[model samples]
Structures are given as C-alpha cells and as structure tokens.
Target: MAKIKVVLIEDSVVALEILQRLINSSEEVEVVGTALDGASGLQVIEQNQPDVICTDLQMPGMDGLEFTKEVMKRFPRPVLVVSNAVQPSDVDNIYNLMQAGALDFFPKPTSGISTDYERLKSALVTKIKVLASKRVS
Candidate 1:
C-alpha cells in the first residue's frame, strides 16, 4: 500500500524536525512537506496534496485555529493538531480547534529528545494513519 503523505506546520524548528523524523520513521506514513508557519503551510499543502495535516497550535503569522479554518475552506483535508495547548486541561482550546475543523489532537511532547518522545512515536503515527482514513470536507 502507498504510504500516507503528511504535511507539517510548526514554528519551532526543533519540534518540526522531531515531528518529521518521528512521522517518517513509520513505514506507513511519510512527511511530504513542512512549513515554519501557517501561511507557508498552505502553499505546501497546495503543492503536496497530502493525506493528512499535522499542525502546531501557536505560530507567528497564522495560528493553528485560523489555519485549520482556511485549510478546510481551501483544501479540505483531515487536520490533526499537534500542540501543547491541546492538553486535557485546556478543554476550551481543544474544543475551539475541533470546532475550527481539526479532526484530532496530540499533545506536543515536552521532554524534548527523551524516552517520552520516543514512546510517543507509535501513538503519533497511529493518529496520523487514523486521520488519513477520515473523510473531511
């Protein structure tokens, strides 16, 4: 089967690199494109036409909420938000992102390059694959 293509939108260079590496490690998924901010993310999306979108909640030009809305209006892809703001305690943030059209959420690993990060790889890839199968319009 063809690997699922994914586009990543994150402002943090470290986080972006880590996410790309983690997602690429999965044989079932691949990071097709990446952008530092939501504006550039849209362009990448247009070019790649990925199966799923992984985005950070906070960005310089356009935040994930606004980005998700634009993406739904323009491209219409399953968007999985990977951000620290989506923690269970932040119900409002999570609800808003979902309301804006995000299909799912994954809390950004805070431990940097550590065991916790490594352990999250499977979960992250699972989320991506699940989202890839979702129908978003």
Candidate 2:
C-alpha cells in the first residue's frame, strides 16, 4: 500500500525535527513536506497535495486555526492539529480548531522526545493514517 502523505506545520524547529523523525519511522506514513508557519504551510500543501496535515495551533504570521480554515477553503484535506494549546483543558482552543476545520487533535508531548518516541510515534502514525482515509470537503 502507498504510504499516507503528511505535511507538518510547526514553528518550533526541534519539535518539527522530532515529529518528522517519528512520523517517517512509520512504514504506513510519510512526511511529504513541512513549514514553519501557516503561510508557508499553505504553499507547501499546494505543492505536496498531502493526504493529511499535522499542525501546531500557535504559529507566527498565521495560526493553525486560520491555516485550517484556509486549507479547507482551498485544498480541503483532513487536518490533524498537534499542539500544546490543544490539550483537553484548553477546550476553547480545541473547539476553535475543530470549528475551523481541523478533524482531530493531539497534544504535544511534554516530556523529552526520545522518552515519548515509541508511544507518540504509534499514536501519531495511527492518527495520520486514519485522517488520510477521511474525505474532507
């Protein structure tokens, strides 16, 4: 089967690198593109035509909420928001992202990347695969 193509939108370099490594380690998913901010993310999405998008909620220039709206307006791909702000405690942020067209949310790992690698990788890859199968309009 073809790997699920994913585009990551995150402003943190370290987080981006870790996410890329984790997602790429999965045989069923691939990181096709990445961008530091929402504006650039839009460009990358246009170029990649990814099956799913994983993005941070807080980013410079344009936030994930706006990015999700724009993406739904333009490409209409399923978006999975990965962000610290999307924690269950932050109900408003989660609601806003979902209202903006995000299909799912995953909280950013609070501990060291390596410590959470195995579990995070499994969850992230599963989410990407599931989202890839979604039909967003």
Candidate 3:
C-alpha cells in the first residue's frame, strides 16, 4: 500500500517538531507539509492535496474549525484534528470538527506530554490510517 500523505497545521514549535518526527517515523504516513497558521494550512492543502490533514484546535490567521470548514467546502479532504485542549470524555470539539467534515480527532500532547505521546501513539496511528482509507468524495 502507499504511504498516507499528511499535512499538519500547528502553531507550537515544539509540538510541531514532535509531530513531524512521529509522522515521519511511521511507514504508513508521510509529512507532506507543515503550516503554522490556518490560512497557510489551506495553501499547503491546496498544494499537496494530502490524504489527510492533522491540525490543532487553536491557531492564528484562523482556527482549526474554520480551516476545516473551508477546506471541506473547497477541497473536501479527510481531516484529523490533533488537539491539546480536549479531555478524554469531552469530545465536543471532535464532533464539531467531524461536522465540519473532519473524520475524527486525537488528544494532542501538550506541556510535559512525553508520556501522553508514548501512550497515544498506537491509537493515533490507527485512526489516521483508517481515516485515510476513506474517500471524501
């Protein structure tokens, strides 16, 4: 099978680096591009036409929600929201993102989140793989 092409939109430098590492390490996923803001995320999306977009909940120049909405409206690709603000049970944002055409979401690692990332890696990879298999059209 082909590797999943992924575009990431995250503002934090540390988190972005970590995510890039994780994504690049996976044989099934590739870091096609990264954007620090939502508008640029859209531009990267248009350019790469990735299989999935992994974006943060909060960002400048726009936010994950608005970017997801616009992306779905125009490009119509699968979106997987990687957010730090969401609690395990509080999946309101996930639903909201899904409503905006995102396929699903994963709780992102925030400050001092090394342990969280190690624990969440398998589930995150699995979800991204599954979502990437679906056709947005």
Question: Which candidate comes out best when scored by lDDT?
Answer: 1
TM-score leader: 2
lDDT of 3: 0.84
Please provide, for model 1 over 26-130, each residue's C-alpha lDDT reduced to its tens digit, 9 standing for 90 to 100: 899999999999999999999999999999999988999999999999999999999989889999988899899999999886545576665799899999999
Over 1-137, each residue of candidate 3 has an lDDT whose tens digit, in order, gives 88999999999988898788778878888989999999998889889989889999899779999999998888887888888765567568767877888888777765675676655666777888998889895
| Residue pairs in clash, model 2 | none
TM-scores for all predictions: 0.96, 0.96, 0.89
Residue-level lDDT of model 2, residues 1-137, one tens digit each, is: 99899999999998898889989999999999999999999999999999999999999889999999999999998999999998789999989888889999998765476776898899998888889889999
Task: Please list the residue runs of candidate 2 whose C-alpha ends up more than 4 Å from where it truly belongs after superposition.
Answer: none
Runs off by more than 4 Å, candidate 3? 89-91, 111-118
Rank order (by lDDT, best first): 1, 2, 3
**Cα RMSD to the true fold for all candidates:** 1.1, 1.0, 1.8
Candidate 2 TM-score to native: 0.96
Give the Cα error of residue 51 in candidate 3, in Å. 0.4
Candidate 1 weakest lDDT stretch, 10 residues:
109-118
Model 3 vs. true fold: TM: 0.89
Clashes of each: 0, 0, 0
